[model samples]
Target: MTSDLRLSRFEYGFAQFMSVMASAPAKLEEKPKERTHQTRDRSREPHSRSMPFRNEMGSEMVDIYVGPEEEPFRVHKQKLCRRIPYFDKMFNGQFKEASENVGRLPEDDPAAFDVLME
Candidate 1:
């Protein structure tokens, strides 16, 4: 007949072939495959943990000083010591003394100074 009629006939046959293929099952689905990994306890040392300090008492001071070149960061140390709970109370007296002795470590007592404006 015409080209449009031939195309419609081919489309009907293609559609029927797809429907039959979808109804058929593959032979691989009936076979059991081997697992590469073994089933182990996923809860131990990973998912669950028990911290000693989390249950018991914690330390008085936590020294976590990390600098650019391993040099002791005086500013961070001063800030960190202020948050030590009991140590913050000594801010007016002992903390002030400690702040005075910060950069004056035996060699630079006169480091705390302003330039002359003459």
Candidate 2:
């Protein structure tokens, strides 16, 4: 009788453990459902027209025309000044670039400028 009681207890405990293990996967599945709902909501949000480097409207205050006549990059002064110390000095200092609305980088490669801009 004592042996039967111990075996029954062990069986009950084993059944409970198995049930918990089975429910764990169900709980994991529920979590992904909630995440999918959140992802769908985020996807519905509007995206900005301007990218990290490119702005197409030509509305930026200043322009930097890089390279020779063959290739050029129209870059924003504020963006350049914010990123590079050399550009900040040239634009903020008492230089011709500061006076004029436009600046030129005749020697610099246009391809290199495109990479920097991106």
Candidate 3:
């Protein structure tokens, strides 16, 4: 089995591989092609009206109360939705949390939530 594997591996010899690599360009020298689509000037639009959920822009914040004491933690809704599946469902779905923009986890540890935020 080992001999068969070795025979297959040697089918393309090291010399042939090296020769091909040597003939190839070290780096591509082509200039970047211009974008074909006309991008809308975002500067003219209001910041709040812009794409809020995009990674480059900051989204609305949400308040999540955790632990027995109900320690409140403020986090970006977009970040939470993008990173955590539970948050994504809760925020986007037809749930009370989506409407209120607040979440409660009375049993979950506040420290764990803090770590998650970090």
Give, for candidate 1, the lowest lDDT window spanning 10 residues.
Answer: 109-118
Cα lDDT computed for each candidate against the true fold: 0.33, 0.57, 0.67
Model 1 vs. true fold: TM: 0.17
The segments of candidate 1 whose C-alpha lies over 4 angstroms from its true place after superposition are: 1-24, 27-30, 45-118
Over 16-93, each residue of candidate 1 has an lDDT whose tens digit, in order, gives 433433443342234556779988675656433445533333333222222233323233333333333222333223
Candidate 3, run of 10 with poorest lDDT: 20-29
The deviation in Å at residue 30 for candidate 2 is 40
Tell me which residue pairs clash in candidate 3: none
Candidate 3, residues 8-105: lDDT per residue as tens digits?
32233433333433433322233546879987778877777645445542568899998899999999898877666567667777899999999987
The TM-score of predicted model 3 comes to 0.53
**What TM-score, over all chains together, does every model reach?**
0.17, 0.46, 0.53
Higher TM-score: candidate 1 or 2? 2
Task: State model 2's lDDT.
Answer: 0.57
1-118 in candidate 2: lDDT tens per residue?
3454444433554454334434554454443334343433446555663454355323456667766763645667777666655666667778887887667776555555555565
Q: Which segments of model 3 are wrong by more than 4 Å?
A: 1-57
